[model samples]
Every structure is written in C-alpha cells, then in structure tokens.
Target: MNRNTFVPVNEPLLKGNEEKYLLECIRTGWISSEGPFIKQFEEQLAARVGRKYGVAVSNGSVALDASVAALGIGAGDEVILPAFTIISCAAAIVRSGAVPVVVDCDPVTWNMDVAQVEARITPRTKAIMVVHIFGLPVDMKPMLALAHRYGLKVIEDAAEMHGQTYAGKPCGSFGDISTFSFYPNKHITTGEGGMIMTDDPALAEKCRSLRNLCFKPEQRFVHDELGWNFRMTNMQAALGVAQLEQLDKFVQIKRRMGARYTSLLAGIPGIQLPLPRTDFADNIYWVYGLVLADSVPFDAKEAMTRLAKLGIGTRPYFWPMHEQPVFRKMGLFAGESYPVAERIARRGFYVPSGLALTDGQMEQVAEAMRKVFQ
Candidate 1:
C-alpha cells in the first residue's frame, strides 16, 4: 500500500448534492439554524423513522441531553445504559443532572444486557438509554416490556444505526425519544448535526424549546427554564437533507461491505465475526467488527496495532464506562462485575466498513488481517 493512499477506518459519503444544497442555503441567506432545510430535514427524517416529529440539534450528545430534559429527568434520577458504548451516553446523563447506571452488554449482540437491566432498575431509575452499537439493534421487545413494567422512559441511541430495524419496526421508532448522529463517519453526514425523534407532541415541543435556550412565548425576553444553545444550523441541515436522500443507497452499500467482510473472515480461526440477527432484516452496519477469541495470541489492541502497521486502520471496541476514571470517581455505578463488557472491550476491534470503501479495499483489509492471524 502506498503511504499517500490511506484507507481510513470510515469516511463520509458525500456527493455533489451536498455541495449544491449548502450553496442553496448560502444563496438563500438562511445559513443559521432557522431555515427551510431544518424543517424539511426533520420531516423527512421523521418519515424515514416512522415517527411523527423530529427535532434537529447541534449533535447527538446534545440530542440525548435534550431528550432527558424534555422528559423531565433531572437530579436524583438514574438512567440505565450499556457500559460498552461511547462515553457520550453516560456524559449525557451526567450533564442532565442524573446518575447513570451502567449495565453490562449482552455477549452476543454487544448491546445492553436485558437481564442485567432488570436487576439494575431501582426506585430512582427514570429511564433506559439503549445504544444500538455498531448498527445492531437491541432486542427491543424485552427491553420495552421491562421499561413498561417499571414505568421507565426509553431513549434509543440510534447514532450508529441510521436505517436498522428490530422486529420489523425501525430502530428509532420504538423509544419515547430517539437520537441520531450526523457526524462525517456515521451512515449520514451533515458536518455536525443530530436529531431527536418522538411521537409525543408535548415532548416534541419541549425538545424544540430546550434546544433554543427555553425561550418563552408569553415573555419575549424572559427564559422559562435553563437550557443550552444546542441548535443545528441550516447549513448543516441542508447537507443532512441531501444526505438523507441517499441514506437507503448508502445503507445498501454498508450491508454489502459488511457481508463481504463476514464471508472473508468468518472461517478464520481466532476470529469471531459479528453475527446478524435472524429476526431483524435491516442492519445498516456502521462498522465491520470482530472479536479475538480467547485462544488468539494477541489482544484487540495488539491486533489493531499489527493491522495499522500493514496500512489497515482498525479501532478497538469502546471501553466500559463504569471503569472509566471519571465515572468511577463519581461513584455512580453499583455493581463491581461487568465481565461481558470488559471482555469485549479487550478482545474486539473493527475493520474499515464505509460507503467510501471499495470492494478491492475490503479485500486488502481482509488480506492484511489474514497475514496477521496466520
């Protein structure tokens, strides 16, 4: 591989449409958060997710925070979430002035362990934030049942699962509030943008107000409650609208690349490939992940470093949030053991799987992995 030609772990799938939409926004002088693109993008996303409303925001983290706030989750509340996820999940809870109860992930799906979730629910438990990590949907049937039993709100972090489905229902449609990220590396890109989807009209209004510093209609200059300036710009929304138009096509490419990776890596010893769910038909893979079995000579970090040396960029699975220094110091987590999350963090790594990657590049990645493991 030439040093000049770098195969990134993931890349944005942008075309001329994105540039054209942005230029239109600039020409219309609607470059700020308030513009036609914002409403159009929100409506289009809501329709895609089978939801009634969608509120665009600055980014996914703020979307999560706004969702929590919209649902009246605040001090002394506990939000259950998988420990094996991006740090933003826990951070969002903390930022909302609530305690995050970190649960272990299911070994099979690497999503929040439903069994652990039941055991973790307390009187203070206000909600459950399910992160569909790497585009694999959590078994929502059982999770939703549990939430209903306990009267806890459900927030779906569909950041990595733009077009995925669970039990025939869309990934973002199940929860009380669902959040998505539009970072460059996600299934879609808007430079930096996010959205909150909900069927409840009241919650939708609250989200809109919260994202704009909780402005009041009665008093023009008066603030009803404390909120942040977490608003998405029209420029970003314009890009998002354009990207949303190509989402299905991009998802198709991702599915094809993921299948190719599995076909090439499945039979390799010491490699445990990601398993597709039988019940779910649509899985928009954000990354092609694999785990090193216990018998493997090296851990995830070692394998990633070796692959990197071969010009194949790879990434380790997320570190369990309960063990992170900040969360541990806060004394938020109760249980001492989260074996599944810890083990996955140590053994798992992901190869490049992006719409931007060619089949030939995937072959190169697979060949590099074979060389490392052989």
Candidate 2:
C-alpha cells in the first residue's frame, strides 16, 4: 500500500446516463419540484419495487416522517423497531409524537429479531417499522404475520436494500408503506433525495401532501394541516432515474466485491468476517465489515484507529439507539438493554465496500489487517 494513499470506506458508482438526463432538465428549465423527471422517476422506481405509487421527498429521514404521518401514527402511538439501526428510524417516530419501542437484532442476520418484536407489542402499538439493514431484508414473513395479527401498520425502510428481495418478493413490497434514500453512499444516489412508496393510493396521496407542505390543491396558500417542505427537486429525480436504470448492475457488482473480500479475509485470526451468505441470500456487504472476535484483546474502535494510521478508511456499526445520550435525556429506553446489538456495535465495522472499489484495493486492505493483528 502507498503510505500517501487512502482507501475510503465507500465510493458511489455513477457511470450511467446521469449526465444525459441531467442536461435535459437544465435545457428545459425543469429544475424545481414539479417536473416530468420527478413523476417519471417516481413511477419507474415504484414499479421496480412492486408498489403502485411513489412520492419523491427531500431526503430519507423525511421519507420516514412522511410514512409515519401518512399512517396517522401520532400522539400516544407506539412504533416497534430494531435498536441497531440509523437514527432516522427512531427520529421519525419521535417527531410524530409517537414512542419508539426498541428491540434487539438477530445475532446472525443483524436485522431485527422477529421474535423480540412480538414481545414489544402492546395495546398502544400502532406500527412496525422494519429497516432492512446492510442490504439484507429482514425475515418479513414473521414480521408481517405479527403485524396482521395485531392489526398494526408495517413500514419497510428499504433504503439500504435496493435491488434486494425477501422470499422472492421485493423488499419494499411487503410493507404498507416503504421508503428509500438516495444518499451518495447508497446503491443508487441522486446526490441527496428520498422516496415514499405504497400500494394503497390513499396513503400515497397523504405522503405526497405531507411532502409538499399540505397545500390544498383547490386553492393556493390555504392549508388545514401543518406539513413540512420535503419535496424532492426535478434535477435530483433526473439523476435518480439514471441511477435506477443501472441499479441491477450495481447490485451484481456489490456482490462480486463482497465475495472477493470474504475470500481474501477468510479465517483471518482475531477477527470474524461477515457471513458470506445468510439464510436469506448472499450477504450483500454494504461495507466489508469485520467483527473483532472475543479472543482479540482490542475492540473495533482501536482496530479502526490502527487501520486509519495505515491509510485505510473504515466505519463502525451504528451505536445502539437505546444507549444514545439524546434518547436517554428524553427518558426513552431508560435501563433498556439489547445485548446482541451492544456486542456487535463494539466489535463490528466495515472496510471499503464501495462499488468504485477495486479488487486490488481489497487485497491491500486485507494485508493491512494482517499487519494490524501482528
């Protein structure tokens, strides 16, 4: 490895028709929220995920917020979800004046523990927000069963699992409402954008209204309800359309990259490689992560620091939300413990798994690990 060179954790691939579509928007002056590209991107992406309608939003966090709002999840409603996930999920629940009931993840898949989900349900529980983490679908069958049995809405956070499926169905297909993010690090990106999708037309319209500041279509500047400005721009949707066109190719590339990393790092001592395949399918390594085994004297933070010194970039897993200071200050999840999540958060993190990453870089990264262990 060159001492002067740094290998980043992720680099988004954008070698499609992004420029062509983007230029069209520029020429036509269709740069704002209402444009053909927005609807086209929304419809195309929604169909790909087997949903009837898609509403473009400003960002992923608001996608979640719009979903919560569309479902009428408010004041005194309780939403159950995994503790080991991005803060956007919990924040959406909190913002809607709903309580987020946190649960641990399965030790193997690192998705939510479906078994634990049932236990968290109560008379006030109104929804289950399932986040398909690290590009793997949560085992949705059980989650769906519980949702049906309890009459609770299911919101699929398919932001990470684009082009991924569960039991031969789309990741976004099972939930009543689903959301996706187009952040640069995702499988596909619009620089910064998001979408909310659903089979229910009413929910879809409600999400659209919430995304657009609740403007009454019949009159201008007349509103009955408060809403945020979460409308995605036409330029972003143009980029998204281009990205979506190449999403299948990107998924294949990601799997290839993940397999190469697994093969190279197989049986590395003191660190446990991410499972090559899970019960669902080949573990699509969003970032090629390694968990320091209990036998190791050091933790993931120390390992990351060592790798950084070697000019290799890495990112740690999400710290369990139940342990967050902000949530604690709010008196939420007080004294709650999710042991599996806590363990992985301390030991797990990913190396370079970017679509733009090369095989040669993986070799260097694996070699750097050998040096770190020594």
Candidate 3:
C-alpha cells in the first residue's frame, strides 16, 4: 500500500442484495414509507433480534425519542444512563420532560458501571437506559435485576451491537424497547435509518403511530397526540432488508477486523488498544479505538491530526454528556463528575474498522499507527 493512500474511518459493505432490492423499489415506485419493504425490513430485523415486532424510524436518535414516548416515560420521571454514551440517549429522556440521571462507565469495558446504578435509583426513577458502547454489551443481568427490583422500564440502545449476544441472549431482547441505527458506518446500512424493537404489541403499535405523526388509524387526518414525521422510506427499508440477510457475515468480518488489528498493534507504547473480548461478549470492533496512556503528551484531537497526516483517517470518542456546554447552560449535571467518561473523551480515538476495509487498508493503518507511536 502506498504511504499516501487514505484509509477512511468507515465505509459500508453493500455487495449483497442492496442493488437488487433497491432496483425493485424503483421499478415498483414504492419509494415512500408505505411500501412492502418497510414491513419486511421491520419484521426481519425484529425477528433477528428476538423481538416480536420492530418499528422502523428515520434514524437512531428519533428511535430513542419514539421509544421514550411509547413507554410513557415523561415529566417527573427520571431515567438512569451512562455518562459515556451519545447524547441521544439523554436527549430522549430530557425531550420527554423527564430528568436524565447518569452513571460513570467501567474503565475496562467502557460500559455503564452497573454497580453505581443501585445507589442512584430514587422514587422518581422510572427507567434505565442501557447503552452498549462501541462493541461490548453492558453487563445486562445485574441491570435487569435492578430494573425488576425497582419496577422500572429498560431501554436498550443496541445501536452498535448488531448480531451481538450477551450470555447467549440477544442484546436487544432484554429491553422493554431496544433501538438500533442503520448508519453507513454500522454493520448494516440503510443509508440512514433506525429501528425500535419490543415484545409488547401495544408498545410496537405506539411506536408505529409515533413514527407517522401519531395519526389516528380510523381517522387518518385527525391527530389525537403530538408526534413527529419520523417514518423510514421504502427505499431505505429496501436497503435494510437486503442488508439484514448478510448480518451474520458482517459480524464475522467485523470480528476478524478487530482480531487482526489487536494482533497487529499489540505492545505499542503510549496507547491502549481495545480489550479484545469480555467474559460475556467478544468485541465486535464497532470502531477500533485507542486511548492515549497518561504518559502521552497530546489529546485525542492531536492524535487524530497525526493519523490524518499519515493518510489514516481517525475519529475522536464521544464527548461526555456532562461536559457539554449546552447541558451546562440548561442547568443539567452541574458540579457532577464522571472521571472515567471525562478521561476517555479527552484521550480516546478510533482507527479505520469499516466493513468495506480491505486487508491492505488494515495493514496500512497498522503501519501508520506504528509510525505515530514512534
């Protein structure tokens, strides 16, 4: 590989039935949300995750919003989640007029510290939002136990854990409502889409209604409640249906990429590689991230700059929700601290680990990583 060849942060693998299904959507003129592929994609993905029904939405963020609304978690309610996850998790709760209570992540697994959750529970806490960060599933058993004990709802954010399992159970199966993203960087891509999955038929119907502006079934034009037009188009669902067929293969590819990177970049100084596997689940390498050791002189932004100069694309980790200026101005999480989340946000970054990444590109990334450390 040429030293100047750029290895992107992510790219989707669409060599499966993506083209065929997309063409069918075009030929049939079923490009809208009310197409056959929409239901097919929903059913297929739901079944894959061991859910009784799936509601397709425009994107992952809205899926969270829909799930929060469907669960009837709103004002005066509090939802406990991790400080280390995307803002969408917290935003969903806040948007519903509920308060978001955050817990720090485990240093090793980068998942919510389940031990901290029990202490945070209060009379007003109505739900727990468990977000599986990167590739590792959050320690679910204890979280579920807590939810059961407290009579609280569980919302599983399995956006990065497609085809991933936790102790022989599917990641999405545990939540009252679980959500997934179909971004291009994900294992499967609907170009841009998301889904909400659940075993409860009423919850599933509520999500479907919410996705389409909460219009009444009997009276289509009459609106009873507020909702957003978060419907997923048939074109997107066509891509999703095709992509679902290849999920197992995609998971394998992701695992292999993770393994190869771990082997290639082992023993490098000044950086910490992702833990290859956990007791409950293997790392899917959602993105092959690295954390700068304390000895490193620069932050993740600087590391990303260095990698970019070497033609190796990289991305910084999620900024902690507590540190966001917007949230601070809004008087949320004031004076609260999550050391693990803060440190990782400053020091963490990920290298190329896309499904479309070629072996040559992986080697190129490895070589670039070595040069960066040297």
Candidate 4:
C-alpha cells in the first residue's frame, strides 16, 4: 500500500451538527468564551453523565488540576493514581503541591488496580484519581467503597470514555469529580475542549471559579486567590454540543471497529487483541491495542516503527510514570516498581481504530499487520 494511504491511530468522526453549530457561533459573533452554546454544552454533558453540574474548561489536564484544587488537596497531601496513564493526572496532583502515589494497572482491564490503591493509602492521602483508560470505566464500586471507608475523594478522568457505563450506571456518575476531553482523537471532537462534572454544589462552584480565574462578581479583577485561565471557548463548546448529539452512535461504531479488528487479527500469533466486553462494560474500542506476547521478537516500539513504514499508524502505550525522568528528578516513586505496568509499556501498541475508519481501512490495517509480522 502507498504511504499516502496511511491509516491514523484515531480520528474524530464529524457526522453530525458540527458545521451547523459552528456556523451558528460565527453568525452570532459568539466565537469566544461568552455564548449560549457554552451553557448548553455544559448542561447536556453533565445531564448525560447523570451529574448535577458541569464546569467547562480549556482542556482535560486543567480540568483535573481544578478538581484537585477545589477539593483542597495541596501541600503535604497525597493523591493515588494509576502509573500507566497520561501524565496529566499526576501533573495535577503535583501542581497542587500533593504527592502522586502511583499504582500498577490491572493487566486485563488496563485500568488502575483497586487492590494496590488501599495498600498505598497513607495518613495524608487526600484522594484517588481514577482515570478510565482507553474507553473502559475503572471498576468503580470497590474503589468508591474504599474511598468512602477512608473519607477520600474520587476524581474520575473519563477522558477516553464516552457513553460507557459500569453495571448499567454512567462512567462519570459515581465520582466526587469527573473530567472529559473533546480532542479530535476522542469519541467526540471540538478541536480541543473538556468538562468537569460533579454532584457536589460547593465543589462545582469552586471548579467554576478555578476555571475562570476566580473572578468576583462584586469586584471584577479583584481576586481573593489566583486561578488559571482555563475557560473553554464558545466555538469549542458549539462543536462539542453537536458532537454530543451523536456520541451514542459514535460509541457503537467504536465497538464495531474493535470487533472487526479482533476478528481480522484473531490468529496472529504473539499478538493479543482487546476484549469485546469485560465484567464492567463493553469495550468501546478507543484504540485497537495489540500487546505482543513474551515470545514475540520485538517490543511495541519496534513493532510500531515497522508498522509506520508499512503505512499503518500505530501508537505505543503509556510509559510507566514511575520510570519517567521528570518524576525521578522529583525524587518520587524512586524505589517503587510496578511490574505489570513495566511489562505492558514494553509490549503494547495500538493500531487504527478511529471513529471515521472504514471497513476497508481496517482491512488494510490488518493486512499491514500481517506483512509486518511476516
């Protein structure tokens, strides 16, 4: 296949009112942060997740930061999270002057290991940041139970998961705070945007303040405390509202893509495909990840490089946070080792599983995989 035909790892499917809403924003001159679309998007997104309130933000990372800040977790505090996630989770805790105590992920679910969470809890533990990895919800019942028992907050990073549920409940419904991203590669695209959701009114107000730079109504620009400029634009929210209207359909397409990839690559030795459904919820196929068996000749990096050469886009899994140079320089998790995370980081890579991917493209991707293996 020609390199021009390369299939991307993930692409947003804009099959709804994106253009229509964007045009409306332009017509009304409400392209910036001020517009009705912002409130509309927030209300719909929060309601979709069964939450009472939502705070729109500039991006997913800052949403996490604001949530941690709103909970009053700071200096001398600790926030436990999965070691095999995007650095945003840890960055938030660290930015708030809290220690990020990382844990290993469950090998099967590729989510934070609940059992390890309690073992890492300390007297100064403030919260457990639960990031739903690759469109699957964390097994939240146990995690929530543990949090309640110890009076710890749960911050749900539902960035990669949309329209996914656990035991028939929405993914974002259980946490003290839940966050979402609307990057182009996510289930929905707003170019770049995110949301923070919660049932707690006080927490919601705090997050809202934190997102808007803590502006006081009585005296504008006279702030009691400092907050970052993390407000989402009305244009982005317009795109999000349009995308949200079609999110359920997008999720169905994602599952189909996963199933197709699984069937097409079934007998490829030394490569493991994602499960269609786990005990918690059906896999939304955020990415059709392939994990090489121990017998494989090369690790995920090498495999991804070869796949790229064959016009197939592949992304390696998150490198274990404990092994990150930046974290090591901070003298955190210095002697700690997460064996499962280390192994997965070495072996895992995801192939094309975009929302806009066609059956033919997936076939090409599978064929390219076979060529690489051969």
Point to the candidate with the largest lDDT: 3
Reference-based TM-score, model 3: 0.98
**lDDT per residue, candidate 4, 1-374, as tens digits?**
66559888777777689899999999989988989999999999989999999999999988998999999999999999999999888989988899999999988888889989999999999899999888577888899999999999999999988889999998888879999888888887788889999999999999989888899968989999898899999999999999999988988898888888889998888887776787869998787877889999889999988888878888889999899899899998989999989999999988887788999999999898898876
Worst 10 residues of 4 by lDDT: 1-10
Between candidates 2 and 4, the one scoring higher on lDDT is 4
What's the TM-score of each model vs. the native?
0.96, 0.97, 0.98, 0.98
Clashes of each: 0, 0, 0, 0
**Model 4: residues >4 Å from true position, as ranges?**
1-4
Residue pairs in clash, model 1? none
Tens-digit lDDT track of model 2 for 297-352: 98999999999998899999999989989999999998899999999999998898
How do the residues 1-374 of candidate 3 rate in per-residue lDDT, one tens digit apiece?
46448788998898999899999989999999999999999999888889999999999999999999999999999999999989899889999999999999988788899999999999999999999999899989889999999999999999998999999888888969999999999988898899999999999999999999889999997999989999999999999998999999999999999989888888789988888888998888888888999998888898889889889988888989888887888899999999999999999989998999988899889898888887
Candidate 2 or 3, higher TM-score? 3
Q: Tell me, what's the RMSD of every candidate?
A: 1.5, 1.4, 1.4, 1.1
lDDT of each: 0.87, 0.88, 0.91, 0.89
Better of 3 and 4 by lDDT: 3
